[model samples]
Target: MPHLHGRVAAQESVFARMSRLAAQRGAVNLGQGFPGTAPPAFLLDAARGALGRFDQYAPPAGLPALRDALGADLGVDGADVTVTCGATEALHLLALALLGPGDEALMLEPVFDVYLPQVALAGATGVTVPLTLDAARGWQFNLGALAGAVTPRTRALLLNSPFNPTGTVFTEEELAGIVALARQHDLWIISDEVYDELYFGPRPTPLRILAPERTFTVGSAGKRLEATGWRVGWIAAPPGVTPGVLGLRQITSFSAPAPLQAAVAAALPVARDAGFYDGLRAGYAARMTRLASGLRDLGATVFEPRGTYFLTALHPHWTADSLLDAGVAVIPGEAFYARHAAPAGLTRWAFCKSDAEIELALTRLAARPELTDV
Candidate 1:
């Protein structure tokens, strides 16, 4: 293991491990962030339409129609869009294209667990900077900490807006600070905006509008349409960055599923209707409110999620010291960070579940009130 690359070693399948645990224990799974339902009906039908027609491999840069649609949605030009298997492949491609041995990349602490391993695998050093959420103010990027962490060796900054785990979306001001940092350090900004459309309120415009050349956004059709298994995701970077992305795309999977790309192309025009995404935002907002209020009523502290379908609970008074076995399978907060990992008492939940499922999960949480005091 010592001789193996740091990236591959760091990259254990957290979701897979927890999924098996949930299956064995019959724990209510708030562990994974994907919806357990089939993708939107219209999107599914569109894929079926392409089965016999577009079933073959697509161009290495991705299908033009899908790429063009992705560009239109992100407000970038089509030349900047390149589709991949999922955000997983898109991120991997970006890391490979932009990073190399001895280079350094900065990441926010409590980020998606998959990222640290990917950065290490790319032969780059992973720098984890913490984002502190004060009970009164909410979660915020620690700019000073980020600034101090950057050096000439730092080549990129990877961030997910509408963040996972914490679900903290950046304000316009926060975006500016980060863009400034990128400009100051000449760092590539890898913006994971998979949850961009799942925001609670006020849809955020991608910062690529501000620094088009320096930012690469990873977008997901799966999260956009509750179609996690569809696995159609894309990378939208500046024209200058496309060649680097293409270079990696050449050796790797090369292209995405042609049928899924066609489906995504068909789904895009429908998915981008302002009213459609607004309805999505509102529904998730309602769910967040429901779960946050429920957890609070049970005397558990809830960290309200802003963008993604996730929220954190700080069981400040839990008696068991850990909550994994309490018929609820929320991930411990420590799994998200490399340093200052929470020892226990913090759990991450997925609100992407159906309303009924969320209610049932809440009931299970209420049933275990005694565990909070142990």
Candidate 2:
């Protein structure tokens, strides 16, 4: 067999492997960040309606109806949108369109693991600026370090608000700083707003308002609507970036799945359902509080999350020499970073589980000394 070129090890996904292991062991899945629920009922009915009626392929860009709805939500026009299979495809397509050899892509460390491999696959140098969490206060961005990481070779900066893994939410002011820096350097800004709807605090406004031309915002119905299986996500770019993204998307995926697109399109009008979203946010917030309080009760220091569906903690006492084991499974913080690797006792637990699941996991963690403090 011939060896394939451009195969980067960084492209390998550990989350999938971990998820498979969890399934095989019948372990709770805190490793993977997927919702465990169905989408809106109206959306499902809409998809059913579209089936057979619209079984054929959609336009290469996307369904005209969906694009229009998305445009209204994003405060952009239909001409500026291109729907992809999911935010994953949208991210990949954007990478293909925006990055090339010698161009450096800058992002925060302790970031999404996908960024490393995707950037490498794009034939671009990846520069990661670390976002260290302060225990005294909530996890915060190291702004000075972030600014210093930007340079002449930097082509794009990827920012994820309501960030995954750490759950650090970016403020409007922080986004303003990022926009200012991008403008100063003429860099493209790729903002992943997949978790924008999962916020526990005031929702961060879109950075698109600052520099619409330079910003590419990625949104997902999977995350917002609890329909991961539906796999409907879109990229909202300016008119200029849309052409490039459309060019890449055609060959990558001519169009999103028709039935799923229909479902997503139907769901868009009420994605931010006040009653549903408010309750959902409150539910996750309660889960977070429970998990954090439980960890503290067990004498572990917890890193509080302001947004997103995760809670991270530090087990400083459980070093390589003095290992303390929590019987429950979690993703190690190191999994999300490229440098200054997260140390032993540093673990991440997801709060997206139901109250019962959360209580069970906490009990399992607290009662089982055999699993920790080696």
**Model 1 misplaced stretches (Cα beyond 4 Å):** 1-12, 317-324, 372-374
Q: What overall lDDT goes with each candidate model?
A: 0.81, 0.77
User: For candidate 2, what is the TM-score?
Assistant: 0.92
- Worst 10-residue lDDT window, candidate 2: 318-327
Model 1 lDDT tens row, 1-374: 34864434444466766767777887777778877556677787898898999988899888899888887777788888888889999999888888889999999888787787788778888888988866666576777899999988999999988888788888888889999989988889999999988876677768788788898999899899998887888899976668767888878887888998988998898877736677777777888899889878877777887789898877675522234466656766778878656534677888887787778777877777575443
Clashes of each: 5, 6
Give TM-scores for every candidate, taking all chains together and pairing residue i with residue i.
Answer: 0.93, 0.92
lDDT (Cα, tens digit) per residue for candidate 2, span 1-374: 96676473344465776566667665666656775455667777888888886678988788898899899888898889899888988888888789998898889878787786788888898898887666687577977787798877889998888788788888777878888888889999899988877887787788788889899999998887777777788999977668877878889879889877877777778655546678778877888898789878767788887778888888755431122133244676777777666645677777776677678766766675643343
Candidate 2 regions exceeding 4 Å error are 6-12, 317-327, 370-374
